[model samples]
Target: MDFTAILGAWIAVGLTLFILSFLYRDNPLFKIAENLYIGIAIGYIFSITIYNVWIPKIYQPVSNRVFTSLSNWVPWVSKFVTPAGDAGSLTPLFPAIIGISLLTRIFPKISWISRYGFAFIVGYGAGLAIPATVATMFIAQIEGTIQPVFKLASGGAIDLSGPALWTSFSAILLCLGVIVTLFYFFFSLEHGKISKKVTKIGIYFLMVYFGAAFGTTVMGRFALLYGRFFDLYTYRTSGYYHATPILILLVLIFFFVYFGKSRKTSP
Candidate 1:
């Protein structure tokens, strides 16, 4: 492989070791790695927004219209210039101004100005999201729950096969789960003895749902951990100049030296 490829492998291995050091204890290496991760992520997101959103949506439209001469001078700029056939209005400038206003939050004295930007964002986001959420979640969920009942009703004869029986049982269980879960959240009326029993069933359904969700999340995390470890193992080979092993040794030496000095200095 190329020298740059090897260098990149070494850097990756070193950073991975630095992050893994947190498992032993919270140390300078871990903090350095953590901050680097966050900083890199923010920088990457900003770059993506500038390229994908800012340049395409805002900058290109304004520049193409206002600076038509530059488009002739720079051949590549001509490609991004909005065509005459398309509507090249400067309407996008409003949102651009709102986005800039949000930066005022960084200055304590002028932070109040950021509220306008925030208000627009919140209002627009909620207006867009609420209807979509209701359509996809509430309506879709109700439709799905009652779908099996409709299927059974439409059928002339009852289903007696093993698969059909299983489906029927599942539909009944799902409906029961939904009803009890809704009742569990209904706090207006006092919970009579019967209501308490129904709510207890809801609790069981909720616990099962939460446990499954947690398990899926844990599995996802483990998959990431496995990928990192696999990369580290691959880097330990001679092809990568034993990047993982060398970095591991360096990290171990640094921890011992730094912590040893600190312990010796302390009373």
Candidate 2:
């Protein structure tokens, strides 16, 4: 590979080793890698937000508004103004004002101004999200749980030996799970012997759900670890000039020398 490509490969290998070193112990190498990753991620996200959101929605619309106004007085400026179809009018500037108000929190005396911006954001977000949440999480879930039972009952005759039996069984189990889980959260009524048993079933269902979710999350993290390991293995080849082996050797030597010196210097 070219020199630049080889250099990039070496840097990637070194950084990967630095991050992996954390499994042994937290040290300067791991901290350096962690901070570098965070800084780069923030810089990338900021650039993306600026280009994708701020420029298109805020800057362009506001600039077009100013240009359109100026063009009325100077005919030559009309050429700089974008088409009316793309101009979002001055509506975008209202949010831009609220966004700027958020920055006022940096000042001590005027920090209270930021509350208005925060209130608008919270109110607007809730207004948009609450209906969607209820529709999807509450209503849709109820519909899904009930729809299957309705279909199973409406079918002329029950077939215990066919897929219909399996479908009906699953639908009944799901309905029972939903009812018991909801009852488990119903604190108004005192839970008696029968109620306790129902709630115990709910507890089992919840535990299974939470365990499955946690397992899926762990598997995703391991997948990322595997990918990084694969890259580390690839860099061991001659095409990357054995960057992985050289870095690993350097890391081992550094650990031994540093710890050895520390032991001698200790009281």
Candidate 3:
């Protein structure tokens, strides 16, 4: 293997092990790993903002359209170049300025300037968000709750026909759960024994719902771990992937054991 790839792989694997060391105990090694991870993430975001966002959306447009329009009024440049097609508005500049103005918050005295940026962002974001939120979360949810898979509007009767009649069963259970859960939150009426019983049913449903969500999250993490382990396993047979990482891992382990500060001592 080449030196560069070996060095890179060793660094990656060493860092991985350093992070994994936290499973045993949180030590200086883990702190170093955690900080490095955060720094890399921030650096990555900056690179993306500069290259992908600012360059394409802000710089290129202003340079091509705004500057070109100005340059065309110049005597020699007017003959040499064509102005970009009129985009009809300079709205992009406002957003670019607001984004830049957000940086003023980093300074103590000029931090007040950032509030305009925050206000514009919040107002604009809410303008975009409210309609979508209403449509999806409010209206659509209510529609889903009321619109029955088991009822026929034309006949004005419940259609109890489907595969094993489970559709009707599910619809009935859903309506009951919704009603009972609503009652659980109804503090206007004192929760006597009967109300307490109904609320208990709601609690059971909530537990089941939360359990499913937790299980799904665990499954997702496990799936990702499996994928990474699969790649590691496949690469193990190849020589380039193995020796460097192993050597680096051993060195790191010895260094941490011998020289690093720690509250916990190893057996």
Candidate 4:
């Protein structure tokens, strides 16, 4: 019931309507809102870059050392002092130097120097990813697929006379299907007739798997769209100022369509 709160609620309703205007058609109002959103996002990113990364990691460390040296306040200079000279309380410069080298990519003339930075980053990323991919996707998946289908009791024995045999056989078949389907894509050597037949079966399984994955992705996209529609509907229905921006957008779209039709009829 607060006046400020009521004003804020109305503003939210107007903004929601503006966003929904996109569904009707591309209008000046929607374009303005879209541009404002992009500008705000860019401003946020710039602020976050300075606060989170640049200031803390680079500026503060170097600035602190410089200030301490100028102040002539060597409280514990012995820790950082080396055999060559009193280097003062300063962090290692190698990381900063590498970071600077990465920034050189912004310049057209010295962009080649950034290749070392790219190589280092790529090499490190690949080194980590290769082992992780092998362990998780390859080894762990293989282990999961080939696990014992039988239920083991606390007495260190499995129920052998149950449905374990059938389950185990199915598991083995599934594992083989996945492996063979993956190998079917590799065309280094010519496959014989029997091998070709097996690979064709593998291809069918692979197709089914890929189709299911695509279907799932499509469902996920639809779900996201549905959620956005729900949000628009709920906000409008809450009596927060019923601005059916989508209706306006639809009107605009129909107007354009009719105008185009009229032009075509004249020709």
The TM-score leader among the candidates is 2
Off by over 4 Å in 2: 2-4, 71-89, 150-155
| Tens-digit lDDT string for candidate 2 (123-239) | 999999999999999999899998455233346654556677778788998998889888899899999999999999999888888999999999999999999999999999999
- Note the Cα lDDT for every prediction shown: 0.88, 0.87, 0.74, 0.71
Clashing pairs in 4: 24-249, 24-250
Residues 1-267, candidate 4, lDDT per residue (tens digit)? 455754665555555556666776666667767887799899999999889987676666666666567545664653664223233335635566766789998898999988888888899899999999999998998788876666666787875754766777777778788778966986898898888887998998988889999999999999977876675565554354443454446546755776577679995
Q: Report the lDDT tens digits of candidate 1 across residue range 1-267.
A: 999989999989999999999998789999999999999999999999999999889977765566565565777777775444343547789999999999999999999989999999999999999999999999998999984642343457776777778888888999999999999999999999999999999999999999999999999999999999999999999999899988899999999998898899999
Clash count of each predicted structure:
0, 0, 0, 2
lDDT ranking of the models: 1, 2, 3, 4
TM-score, cand. 1: 0.85
Worst 10 residues of 1 by lDDT: 147-156
Better of 3 and 4 by TM-score: 3
Cα-lDDT of candidate 1: 0.88
N/CA/C clash count, model 4: 2
Q: List the residue pairs that clash in candidate 2.
A: none
RMSD (Å) of each candidate, 1 decimal: 4.5, 3.2, 4.3, 6.7
Pitting candidate 1 against candidate 4, the one with the higher lDDT is 1
